[model samples]
Target chain A: MLDVFADYMTYQVFEITKGSKLGDAVNFFIYDSLKIFIMLAIIIFFVSIIRTYFPPERTKQLLSHKREFLGNILAALLGIVTPFCSCSAVPVFIGFVESGVPLGVTFSFLISSPMVNEVALVLLWGMFGWKIAMIYISTGVLVAIISGYIIGKFKLEHLVEEYVYQMKVGQNEIESMTVAARLQYAKDYTKEILRKVWLYVVIAISLGGFIHGYAPQDFLADYAGKDNLFAVPLAVLVGVPLYSNAAGVIPIVYALMEKGMSMGTVLAFMMSVTALSLPEMIILRNVLKPKLIAIFVSILVVAITLTGYMFNIVL
Target chain B: MMKIEILGMGCQKCSTLLETTKQAAEELGINAEFVKVENIKEIMKYGVMSTPALVVDGVVKVSGKVPNKEEIKALLNS
Candidate 1:
């Protein structure tokens, strides 16, 4: 229904404007904006409700003292629904540790929370179709699990700030919420998220529209082609410092893909941008020592790079 | 009058706890003060590990999970 509406509007505009540059830009913008916004609203609403079930407090309880492999998987999965903000990094870390959640399992949650979030999934699904979205989700979760397991193997718990280990928060009471309250929570969450990123979505879609209408078709393909060995790593490196959620970065991703940037490279870039950003790292630094942070970054970088190469090789 | 502190980051659970606690207090017709402690340092001071914790009169009552209104009422009375 949405696609048909978008297509009809674009078609009408193209005819009315005689297929001019303005027409093309307007068409691209209208189609992308309508599709993305609708998708965001619907997906975020459902995901928000799901999130109400898996708050950090609950996730900490589930993953605490869980065995290594199962813990990594569960943590990564929980990371999907757990609502985590950078500012809460310190307390959540302390909370998880005090509750016996392993450092590596916590890392899995942290990595996947940003990297494979609902926002990223919905945007990818809306713009790129489900095939690429599925691939991104699977690979993202896999990377989180593997990286966390690797970190766990190293037994780097001691590398956490000494203060985290020493601080103990005794168990507290768990609250049961009514369905109405849960719905209200979901409503508020969706509003908060949409309010934060609405402008970014508009800007991103507008840029995407401009690129779709005007940019040369072969720019990225010729330069950052799949055959280029350095393309994947370079994209990841560039993406790390540039902080943006999947929704905010979708316009660039769309433009790049249109320009023939390989899926592997784009996915790698997206992972690096969401999961390995500098600001998130600094926030985590309050809980993790420098050495542990370095290890985390290196593992993620290597894992994401490998994912990129695998995609380039296979698809 | 009673003092109630909801300790957690401003996540959904914390907000639920806040509302639930408020409702519990209102149903019981108890005059109470509700405070949301978002600062990590202050929350840690209470030795509350998980988020969405409840503190009554500066005593840690619950640490994690969003308890229902009935539980809140019991906690409030106790």
Candidate 2:
């Protein structure tokens, strides 16, 4: 029986390799690389445009002594206009406090920046069409706002430094430059991010391309197919360690779904890959206390897993 | 010239605040130097436990949060 299985595996490998030349593989890699670059470039471009035209500093004016709920809503909107990554979220987090922005409101901003971002949206659209992308973005923003409001309602503002409320930083640090200069700033910013994250993109896309080309459709169908309830959380778990995020992972999700993986599992995997990545966690440990960081991660796990289950049932 | 120090481990918010401060300073005609402080030992020197702390001139004015451009400007001017 083992010999039979081995023979079958050999045959499968041979079948996959047959008629597929090195040129074809190279072409596939190049095609996929362009797709990755285009999607990422669009996101980077959008982020730069927003940074140049409407800085997050402007949003500080909105949360000026507003009600917590309203402040959270505005914060989410601000996160939409200002595209910051998890790494840069801290300085602006400081800026919000020094500007008198409320704590609950700040949470909304934090959630929106990482959860519903340009990179995620464009990649989702590239892989799964605009409709799904729109749904994903809208839902993501909503989650940020609602979670912030909930946290605000609990009056967790005291968790912040007392000095934050009384303090002030000047407005001299606002946007100031000509169109050409701003453009340069944006371009340079995009290139910097690209340089940092291109490796992840390449890894994600290359793996996805190979899976697209040769993964066994029947096995994937039997295991991760639409009917398998276990696949959702399993996918989520498998995805968390990969750390590529929504932009890098969505293409793989799309390709896999096309080859018969369930949408719910794929989406859960995507969310896990983006929201609960190991690198994000490593980066997070610098600012957040272990308990608080653990809480944050737990919230994400519950929320994303639940989301996956719901999708499993509905879609 | 005003000197501003931003303390954080290079999170998105810290970087944005730094960018926003630079922009505000340019727009407001304030001459300044902006520096990012990522080392924990250095940040702790200012008694900052949380990240993205801000120091204007030599005094630690903002720690653990992003300050508005205006407020940063005011700190610089003051």
Candidate 3:
């Protein structure tokens, strides 16, 4: 009976240790997790410097008081430089309105905030290549500009909050500080920001790492990565409802590439998740009514899908 | 204690920074009262050009990017 029990225990151990997936997951958690973490650290440092240079109010002022298309174009341009998302959203929205910037123009700024972040761009360059990074950045800027202009042309002024019109542009609260004060401020805020989302980045990157290291190549090529006619549109559709951001998504993109997912398909998905997340939509509801939000989401979906297809064709 | 704020408009990256920073702190044996500064005005107050910033003891250590647990640990330890 004792001999029988030992045999059963050994069999159980063998079963647990035999699968390749378990080893993959373990190795991934160990090796890939570290790489993802390091990348995130670098991004955090870059973001810190940006926080020190551009404040939301400053960006808002730049985008305020311009022709709709011009302002939207400017906002998209500024969005590339400026940091922060929802925080900038309402403030920029209010600032633009107070300065008579067009609604569509402001939307451009809003759209680009999440999609074309600086850190994500850098990581993409390192992970994929500069060509792809430039492509992503240009396309992101283009989306912001075009979408903003389209909404501006419609003169969707009525969609803005009444309070926004009445709101005055407040002077930046931290302007009087010395250099030391400014540096201190940046460091403090960087820590705060890092505190919130580092884990998710790690988790997402771990998944990415796993994919990078272990996902099957031919399976991916045949399915998600292919230049199939439906691939781009399908990727967009799949990406839309998901809520992972670029930071989390990029590492995964590396994995996807290994798994045979096309760069274009992954990008479409990342764009949707970063720019049009469900949470962002929910927050927007506070400032924008459901109708406006729905329109925005719809437009983004189409734009992202088109972008994906275009990329696959061009690349 | 470290002061941390994530600047991105509440995206997953921002959220990831929060969790990873804490993990870093714990791994390095430090205590921090982390703050999430979601207000763009507040982010601008610190002059953060990027969302999701990391501040240690009132210093802007990282911004616009997420850090891994070990990196966070190093920041705390250093």
The lDDT values for all models are 0.83, 0.66, 0.67
TM-score for chain A as predicted in candidate 1:
0.92
Per-residue C-alpha lDDT of model 3 across residues A1-315, encoded as one tens digit per residue: 443433344345444353367644554454444554455567666665665566665665666677667787778877775765554455445555566666787789888877887666766765567798889989998988887787777666677556556554434333444778566656765566556556655665555545544545556788776558777777777776677656666655666666777878888877877787776677666567687887888888888888888888788
lDDT by residue for model 3 (B1-78), tens? 456555555767778888888777777667678787776555544545445677677666765556667767777777
TM score of chain A per candidate: 0.92, 0.73, 0.77
**Model 3, runs deviating above 4 Å:** A1-47, A161-163, A166-174, A189-215, B1-78
Tens-digit lDDT string for candidate 1 (B7-61): 9867677998999999999999999998999877678877565577789998887
DockQ of 3: 0.10
Error of 1 at A160 (Å): 1.0
Q: Write the per-residue lDDT of candidate 2 for residues A73-164, one digit (tens) a residue.
A: 77777776575656555456666666667767877777676667776776677556787787777766766777777666666555554544
Q: Point out where model 1 deviates above 4 Å.
A: A3-15, A18-21, B1-41, B46-78
Query: Evaluated on chain B only, what is the TM-score of candidate 1?
Result: 0.96
Better of 1 and 3 by DockQ: 1
